[model samples]
Target: MLSHVEVTARVALTSVAHFVWSNRLEYAHDCFVCRRVGRTVSLHPNAENGLCHSSERRLEWQDDIDVAGAHPAPIRVTGFDTAGDETSQRLRCRLAFWWSPFFDLKRPDERASELSEKRWVRLHYRVGCHVCRDAGHDDWFGPQNSVQSNQVWPVTSSCQRCDTELVTVAGPPEINLVG
Candidate 1:
């Protein structure tokens, strides 16, 4: 049998290969309601948030005119753009699926020093509780279901909003590039 160091080195080297090897992951945050891109400002006095209704008026902007006021700050929607096509999408989906906290094993870096380690890993999952699941998202694929989140090894967590324990489990072995 290999010594502990030999085993650790092997695991570390292998886990690195499991990472999605892409240079082109781009992130975006826009208003989910209006699809208004962020980093921009309204050009005119519009319903506290709607586009200016100041078109050369057959009617006119009333002093007390009512319109659907958008959120004081637009509700930020998020998405990413992959540089490559189908292959990249597949790779991303694979990596995302394994990002869950493992139930039985310590994170690879703790067991294998050869692996480069970070203080935290970015993950996007939700505490499956009605209180935490935004205002509306109940079942699956809700905007709040996968908010910006993270985890560390020896994974332990409580709902950020609810203080309930989150159950996490390891799935099939992470995909590795051994060949």
Candidate 2:
């Protein structure tokens, strides 16, 4: 039999792997964006200015968890660019997990019934521009323009309304169990 630690590790690892793999496409897509912009980006919890964009050209998934009885889990991932800062940027992705027996999870007795309590996971991506801005100007809009001056600001960083820090994860939950 597997020790509790082993079982837990397996489960956690599985969870993480599943999380990473299931979201690999997303990660890759984000990485592609960062690469195109020539900057490093992270796709995990606690990332700085990490959130994704919505169809409406607005930042998506910026809410925090507040389930009644269960807790939340958050992870941060980061990525970087290789072409140097001129056209480079840094990206951060944050994922939050929320649990609620009533809505998110099923009762203990339903474990094997395909209705077991489950945690709801929410993902957010934040891309920050560490280089020069306002590259849309004619002088900054050329193939040979300075890499730093020729970069376009990421839509993920600009607030739709206020145009500020587009997204921010809620404070870490007070209760979290890793077993």
C-alpha lDDT of candidate 1 relative to the true structure: 0.23
Residue 46 CA error for candidate 2 (Å)?
A: 9.8
Give per-model CA RMSD.
21.7, 17.7
Q: Write the per-residue lDDT of candidate 1 for residues 1-179, one digit (tens) a residue.
A: 11110000001111101112222211111222332222111211122232222212112122232234423332111222223332111212111100112221222232221111211111233324444455463442212221111223234334444454443322211212111
* Top candidate by lDDT: 1
lDDT of 2 by residue, 1-179 (tens): 11010000000111101111112112111112111111112233234332332221211221321223221112123322112132222222232222222211222233221111121222222232211124232322112101111123321223222233322222221112223
The superposed Cα distance between candidate 1 and the true structure at residue 92, in angstroms, equals: 9.3
Error of 1 at 104 (Å): 36
